[model samples]
Target: MAADTAKVDPMHQFAIEPLFGSDWTFAGHNIAFTNSALWMLIAGICLWIFMIGGMKREVVPGRWQMAVETMTGFIDDLLEANMGKEGRKYVPYVFTLFMFILFANLLGLIPLPLAMAGVHAFTFTSHFTVTGVLAIMTFAIVLTVGFWKHGLHFFSLFVPHGTPPLMIPLIFVIELISFLFRPFSLGLRLFVAMMSGHVLLEVLSSFVIDAANAGPGYGVLIGGPSFILMIAICALELLVAGIQAYVFALLTSLYINDAEHLH
Candidate 1:
């Protein structure tokens, strides 16, 4: 009966509950702080500490400074590859974006078991609402830069140079649609990728627990394999977290490049 009573729902961990209270309102909308928000704040703080550590200005750099400089250099190189020297000016925002997403993704995999202690370890990137907002912000910047720099000529982005008259309309419509759909794809990609890995880990965890509770035979047969796979997947999730962050920042730079160069 005890074994039968134990239950596991893979999606349970993603639930967002108000940490302070749900009464927070602004402009007639609930704006209560949540587990998701708490984690985001934590990530922001961690990023700040990371950046501040790099400001030591020591002639002989330590590992802390090196790590920070490495990340900054990597992003700078990425932007340069995508946008040339003009990309240097955009480093602050892009670096922050990359580190924030990287922190959010890695923090979610800390294995702290906060839920068991009546605390939640939230992954904001797993939520479409959060990811979508980031994507929209990047997209908004691209649009703003495009229009600001080129004025109405920004529309030329939808029609490549030397586009034949007959194909211009079709190409323009296709390009416009593909451009507009980018935010949705960007958001959905990160949200689904992050959420799916966590879900699989949760499901395998249930198998490991319930199978072990069943009997030694089941434990060896099912629990063992599930536990091993879970560990492997957990490690893979770490790599996936970094990859997702890199991809998000990379795409942002690419989109910004398009706006800058209109190519």
Candidate 2:
């Protein structure tokens, strides 16, 4: 039974085989080209084309300009709601993040040349390397902007305005922990949501297939429910893609505000 089950490669569900030789060389180093890179490239290109190609403004607004404007307006509202009038200054960075993550998540949704998060044998979305990079980037941005705006006073963020003398040390430690964990929390939230959605889709679909393989009548009965679940998961993923992007961007803007004002 184990051998028979092993014969059915779960890896095959994500049909995108690696794009390089076994000794996949990159800059004289053997580096395999996984589907993650392919999708990341797709994400990058999609962002470039949409942002640069669409918003070439002149006199009257074109279709692309209108579309771009709509997205920007939505982001503007998000910033305004969270950070008030002061938030608009951070819009450029926030919007860029929104577009990048938006495209990345959207690209993952399509069953094209790469595995969609949970569909892969090992959930790529859960890969800490990717999440770590995102976390580091956000961390660096917060540090850079904070230091630039407040210089040494940015450290004061960890020093609360109202604190008892005895609790000062304890408060400082707590604030340090919270500040340090911000990027990790942000990245994990996005990764977990995407990974879980894809996993559900694959598991449900696999169950249906496996059930059918067991017996024709059993397969038929399971097929309807399993397929429905798969479709619903796919739809949920669409929402996840948008929401995750927005959430990431929103957090980024909030971080920027923290930096600028040190509050």
Per-candidate RMSD vs. true structure?
1.2, 4.0
Q: Which residue pairs clash in candidate 2?
A: 24-31
- Residue ranges of candidate 1 with Cα displaced over 4 Å: none
lDDT of candidate 1 over 1-263, digit per residue (tens): 76766678889899999988699899999999998999999999988998898999798989999989899999999999999999999999999999999999999988886667857567899999999999999999999999999998999999998899999989999999999999999999999999999999999999988998899999999999999999999999999999999999999999999999897
lDDT of 2 at 252: 81
Each prediction's TM-score against the native? 0.97, 0.82
Best by TM-score: 1
In model 1, state the lDDT of residue 235: 96
- Cα lDDT over the full model 1: 0.94
lDDT of 2: 0.75
Model 2 vs. true fold: TM: 0.82
TM-score of candidate 1 versus the correct structure, residues matched by position: 0.97
Number of the top lDDT candidate:
1
